[model samples]
Target: MKNKIIGVCPNCGANVVEREKGWFCENRECRFVLWKDNAFFKRLGKRLDYHVADKLLRDGRVRLKDCKSAKGKTYNATVLLSCEADGRSKFSLEFEGGC
Candidate 1:
C-alpha cells in the first residue's frame, strides 16, 4: 500500500508520509520522522495518532486533553515538537498555570 501524505516536514519542507512504523519525510536525505509507537507518548499513556501528529507538524505544538500520568492520574497539557540538529523529532509537555 502507498503511504499516505500526512504533512510537510518542518526540517526540509518535503512531504511527510505515513509509513507502517512511522511518518517520514519524502526527502530521503531529511531525517524528519514521527514514530507511530513513540516512546514519549507511550509514557504518558497515550498513543500518537494522526490527529495529534497533524497538529504537531502544522503548528509545532498540540494541546492534549486527559493525558494519563504514570501514577494513573489524568491531566491536560500542550505537547511541543522540536527538531534536533539531525532532524529527529523531540517532544516536551507544558502544563497549565506554568507548572
Candidate 2:
C-alpha cells in the first residue's frame, strides 16, 4: 500500500499514521496514541474506525453516522477531540441540543 497522510497529531502536532490497530503519532517524542479499541466508542456500540480517527486528527472533530445513546436509542452526533496538557488525547460527544 502507498503511504497515506492520515492527519496531524493533536498532542505534538506531528503527522499521525494508520496502522493495523490504530492511529499513532509519527514523532517518537510525542508518544500520542489513539487506539482502535478505545472504550469511548465501544460503549456507544461502535468501533473506533479509521475514518473517524482521520477526521478527528485532521479537523479535531468528527460527525458520527450513528451511535446508541444512554437510552438505547440511535442518534447522530459530533465528536470533539482534545488533548490534555500532559499530552493525552480525549474524545467527547456533542448532541443536537448540546449534551
CA lDDT, every model vs. true structure: 0.92, 0.82
* Cα lDDT for residue 31, candidate 2: 65
Error of 1 at 51 (Å): 0.9
Colliding pairs, model 2: none
Which regions in candidate 1 have their CA more than 4 angstroms from the true location?
none
- Candidate 2 root-mean-square deviation in Å: 2.1
Give the winner by lDDT: 1
Window of ten residues with lowest summed lDDT in model 1: 43-52
Q: How many clashes in each candidate?
A: 0, 0
Q: Write candidate 2's Cα lDDT for 1-99 as tens digits.
A: 854558888888788887877788888878677899999988788888888888788788888866987789899888899987777788888887763
The predictions' CA RMSDs to the true structure, in order, are 1.3, 2.1
Model 2 earns a TM-score of 0.85
Worst ten in a row by lDDT for model 2:
1-10
Instruction: List, residue by residue over 10-93, the lDDT tens digit for candidate 1.
Output: 988999999889899999998999999999999888899899899999999999889999889999999999999999899999
